[model samples]
Target: MAAFIIRRLLQSVLVLGFMSLLVFVGVYAIGNPVDILISPQADQADMARAIAALGLDQPLWQQYLIFLKQALSGDLGRSFAYSIPAIQLILERIPATLELALTATGIAVLLGIPLGLWAGLAPDSWPGKLIMTGSILGFSLPTFWVGLMLIMLFAVELGWLPSGGRGPTTELFGIPVSFLSWEGIRHLILPAVNLALFKLALIIRLARAGTREALLQDYVKFARAKGLSEARVVCVHVAKNIMIPIVTVIGLEFGSVIAFAVVTESIFAWPGMGKLLIDSINVLDRPVIVAYLMVIVSLFILINLAVDIIYSLLDPRVRIGEAKT
Candidate 1:
């Protein structure tokens, strides 16, 4: 296990090193930041000084080497746009993004699993058909459009919830979270639900497929032959076996939710990293953009590592396979 973990960690380092190069080059290639920073009326000396101050005067390869060195020491550099540490700016918005992502994932698991299990168990029934239909529609609809419709119904028409924003927050465990308070939860619902729709649909399909496959396995037949109740057989034998894939999907999708919440955050005006990213892009803020991408990449790697560990734990065959490798 230690060797497995060390191997994975080494692989993660290589992935991040490659990612940093791509992100740095890609961000640098996107028009000079000096264009946006200085006035057109500024003379040659002003331009030269500004370029030198930003180290934009240096060769691209030299600048990247400098960036790579600083990044190794945990310095992402100051944001030209905000004049703050890039990591600090990203961290400040993490709680909001985390809260939203986790809430949506919670909703997906709570509702999706059971519905999918039911659908898988009785594929010919009306309720199963309904679930299948809903899942299909859930996959079909765009997140932004769904968010708008939800706001129209829940906020504009019913007036039960606020249209957007994180709402008032109180610190819980040193992290400011909205769901701690009732009002905050209300404000959180629309965006969370919007963000959850696609993920929920995906979970439903994955769970259903896993359940169907598990039900046909010999262990399930053995459980049934022993006169175990239908619910017990399904819940214990079937659910346990199927959970390996479900857990894998959940772990990986949680990272995706954080990375892809930009549309939902924009629609709802939620003050998360997604919103921050959009504002930075508009001004061509390279530090924030690159920093955000790096953070997202790091999160993905960590999540994948966790998923691998969990997957191996849940299925002994996987552990054995890794040992052989």
Candidate 2:
């Protein structure tokens, strides 16, 4: 298990390096750095200083090496637009985005699993057919449109919740709180539901398919023949077996939840890395853009590693050479 983990970690490092190179090349290919310095008014001395400041005077290979070294050390350079350390800016925004993603994922899993189990158990029933049909439509709907509908129904029409932002502007229990408080949970409802709707649909379908397959297996039949109660057979024998594939799907979807939350954040005015990345891109803020990209790539690799470890624990057969056990 240790060796497997180490091997995966090494592979992730290589992948990140390749990703960084691709981002660097893509950004540089878009325009020359000198153009950014002399667009409005051309001044020879100013141009020379700007070129030196940005390391444009250095060889391309040397500049890339410097960037790599600084990035590895967590420098991430200063934001060309913000005039602040890029890493610091991203770090400040991390909590809000992480909170939103985590909240949405929890809602998705809680709602999706039970619906899936019911649909699978009663595949021919009206409730089951309805659930399946609804899930398909939910999965096919665009996220931005879903967010808009939620805003209209919950915020504008109903007036049951705030239109946008994280929370009410107030304090609780003598403590100052922003949109991140318990009162703020109401604000999170629309955005979280919007973000989770698609994932919930996918998870429900996957879970239903997995449970149906497990129910058809020989072990399930044997459990029934052994005089076990139907509920016990389904819960202990069938559910356990179905978990392997469900775990895989859940992990992949959870990773995607974080990756795709950017658009949802934008629509709902939620402060997160996704919105920050989009804003940075619009301004052509290279430092912020590169920093955000690195953070996202790192997260993707980390989530996959976590999934692999969870898989090993859930199924011993997945452990390296563990089939011999």
Candidate 3:
């Protein structure tokens, strides 16, 4: 396990190094920030000062080298727009995004797995068909349109929930969270539900497929033949085997939820990293853009690493020593 982890860490470093180059170059090529950042009314002296201050005066390769050096020391530099360290800015918004992503994923797993198991256990039943139909619709619908419909129905028409915003939060271990208060939960529901639809649908399908496959296995039949209770047979024998793949998907998808919550955040006006990223992109805030991408890349790597470890533990066949090579 130690050698496996070491090998994976080495691979992750290489991936991050390559990705940093690609992300830096891509952001650089996306039109200069100076044109928008510096007013046309500014004098040459002012322009020169601004350019030099932003380090845009340096060559591209030199700028990247400097960024690489600063990044190594955990200094991702100041945002051209926010006038603050980009990493600090991103971290400030992380709690909101993390809360949102976790809530959404929780909804997916809690509801989806049971429904999927039921459907897989009895595909011809009315309730099973209904669940399957709902999953299909969840898969088919576009996120933006669903978000709009939800806002209109819940916030505008029914007045049951707040349309947007994170409402209120209290600190837990110095991190602000909405799930602590009832009012905060009311505010979280619409957007969290909106964000969860697609993921929930995916989990449902995966769980259903895995359950069906697990039911056909010899172990399941053996369990039944051994006079094990049906619930124990299904829940313990079947569910455990099914969860191996689902856990992996859920881990990776959690990272994606964090990275791509921009649409949901934008629609709901949620104060999260996704919204910050969109704002940064509008003015070509290169530091924030690059910093955000790098942070996301790091998160993906970390999540992947955690998932790999979990996968190995869950399934003994995934040989750690053999995979290290």
In TM-score terms, candidate 2 sits at 0.90
Candidate 1 global TM-score: 0.96
Top candidate (lDDT): 3
lDDT of 3 by residue, 60-179 (tens): 999999999999999988999879999999999999999999999999999999999999999899999999999999999999999999999999999999999999999999999999
Question: Candidate 1: where are CA atoms >4 Å away?
Answer: 320-325
lDDT (tens digit, per residue) of candidate 2 on 1-325: 7788799999999999999888877776666646653566868888888779877788767877889999888788788767899888888777667677777888878888878888998999999999999899889999999899988998899999887777653444543334456678887788888888888898789779978988898988899899999889877776676677767877787777776788899999987788888888766677788888888888888888888888777777876646483
Error of 3 at 54 (Å): 0.8
Question: Alpha-carbon error at 240 in model 1, in Å?
Answer: 1.4
* Model 1 alpha-carbon miss at residue 118, Å: 0.7
lDDT of 2 at 100: 76
| Candidate 3 off by > 4 Å | 319-325
Ranking by TM-score: 3, 1, 2
Question: Which residue runs of candidate 2 sit more than 4 Å off their true CA positions?
Answer: 32-48, 168-180, 321-323
List clashing residue pairs in candidate 2. Answer: 167-179
